[model samples]
Target: MNTRPIAAGLFDEGASPRLRGGRHRQTGRFVFPCPQGGERDSYDEVRLASTGTLWSWTIQRFRPKSPPYTGPEAFEPFALGYVALAGQTIVEARLTGMAFDAIRIGMALRLTTLPFATDPDGTTVLIYAFEPDGDRAS
Candidate 1:
């Protein structure tokens, strides 16, 4: 089966995947998934850091409303969090590879991807996420 990122220009699929972010040309502020259309002109496209510290998190116990929630019909709870990319910006992403209770603020995390859903054509769509970084965690 073929695989693809959930959205174009969202992240790279190289040996080390990185989220595609944008740096404001004036303030140097960073934003994820890069801006589109006219807003694209004022920023420089950059790959985001692969590692970060978990800033905050919460458990998503119920299936989110549709139109945006495209997961499986049989809903399951999930963990989502904001990860601070050091001097860069904090990014909101799903947390994985650990139990919800194990997640901690300031815990080291690494960029990763998870299978979101399969397209009608059978292509597995992947979404960006953050996972515990065993090597860097205290």
Candidate 2:
């Protein structure tokens, strides 16, 4: 299972799992591993969320500089963008599983987890992405 909780102390009201330095039940803080950024201790707050609009986007014509970039070299075109979450901090990520022609500015988007690819060393890279909100992408 994708143990990395998409929602943790974020929506849950409390003394704050992060502020208290306690491990979050969903995303896991002090202990367990986070599939997204991996086991250290950065997801200590609500830095990102699903409630963002498609502020802007662009199609990349070349492969990224890392192994996790799995888009076909022949294809040479993929979407990436900055998702402005409800609060501060903007999440830079790829926008996929949708058609470029249909994507537009100011569209509703939700947070999603995407499996990039396995590295030569055998570590699976997970990426945080956003997808158009079903029926609310306008």
How many pairs collide in each candidate, listed in order? 0, 0
Best by TM-score: 1
lDDT of each: 0.91, 0.55
Q: Which stretches of candidate 2 lie over 4 Å from their true place?
A: 1-44, 66-76, 120-123
Q: For model 2, how big is the CA root-mean-square deviation?
A: 9.1
Best by lDDT: 1
Worst 10 residues of 1 by lDDT: 8-17
> Per-residue lDDT for 41-115 in model 1, tens only?
999999999999999999999989997888878888999999999888999999999998888899999998888
Writing each residue's lDDT as its tens digit, candidate 2 over 1-138 gives: 233223343222222211112345564533222224453245443333455788789998766764654543445476888766554445566687788888887778776656555455555545556777776756
